[model samples]
Target: MAKTQLNVRVDEDTARAARERALERGMSVNRYIEELVRQDTGEAGHTFVEAAADFMKQYESVFAEEFGAAHEGRGEGSREHRNEGRR
Candidate 1:
């Protein structure tokens, strides 16, 4: 991949924070910012649908336990009697 230099300006406090975060992550400030952008943009590779599916799968048992019975019985009782023989 081709890399380009990007000049950016940040307030002194922001710059200090970024430097500290970069050190904590064992990355250069530029790399830390790049990773952040990549993750935010989903260029880190997982698509939105894939991410959502994974999240749902992780908590699927919780949802099923909570609503499975309610959903299962949702349409069992008819609201009104229908005219079965006449159109």
Candidate 2:
């Protein structure tokens, strides 16, 4: 895989905070930023589907209470119908 360099400019306060936190964790500022980017990339961390599933699992009880039974497959009120009003 090819690697590229990225340069970002952050506010003084944010940079200070990042540097302090990185030092506390015994990691360099670059490594801390790299870990964050890797997590967001999904391919290296959790895929979007896996992340969504984990989120739903964590909030299943709250969602069930608010929205009632969770729909399985394409039931009566599926998200597939979301674009029906667009046309």
Candidate 3:
């Protein structure tokens, strides 16, 4: 994609908040703002939930065969269960 530079102005408090948010995400303020715009405009790519569902659907049988015993009684929501480790 072709990149273009945009100049924006905001109050000091807003700029500081942007910087803090960007820092927390380990991204530069420019990239953080870019992502915010993408999400707001619904141009963002597939979300983690969508991707994770796809992955679980693809490997569900394999996981069942291997980990079925361990997952016994945990119910059918293994997808949510598997995501616990990420947190």
Candidate 4:
């Protein structure tokens, strides 16, 4: 893949922090920024729907458990009783 240069301006403190973080991570500042952008843009490149689906799949069990707990003991037909021919 071809790489392009991007010049951005930041406050002195932010630049210093970025440099320190990059050094701590053993990456050049450019690579650090690239990684930040990659994460912000999402891995596997820009497919938000795929990412959302993966997120849902990952948390589906948790969601189901919470939902079941919330609805537990409501009894069957509780919802229908509430509606009661209101259509």
Preferred candidate (lDDT higher): 1 or 3: 3
List candidate 1 segments past 4 Å from native. Answer: 45-87
Off by over 4 Å in 4: 44-87
What TM-score, computed on C-alpha atoms, does each candidate reach?
0.51, 0.45, 0.54, 0.50
Q: What is the C-alpha lDDT of each candidate?
A: 0.84, 0.81, 0.89, 0.87
Off by over 4 Å in 3: 45-87
Cα lDDT tens digits, model 2, 4-87, are 788999999999999998999999998888877777776654576788999999999999876665565457478767667676
lDDT of 3 by residue, 24-79 (tens): 99999999999999888766755756888999999999999878877775755776
Query: Whole-model lDDT for model 4 versus the true structure?
Result: 0.87
lDDT at 54 for candidate 1? Answer: 94
> Which TM-score value belongs to model 3?
0.54
| By TM-score: ranked, best first | 3, 1, 4, 2
Candidate 4 per-residue lDDT, tens place, 1-87, comes to 899988999999999999999999999999999889888878635666788889989999999898877777576657966787687
1-87 in candidate 1: lDDT tens per residue? 999999899999999999999999999999999998889898877766788899999999999988887666656352322333334
Q: What is every candidate's alpha-carbon RMSD to the true fold? A: 6.9, 9.7, 10.2, 5.6
Which candidate should be chosen as best, given TM-score against the real structure? 3
In candidate 3, which residue pairs clash? none
Give the Å shift of residue 84 in candidate 2. 48
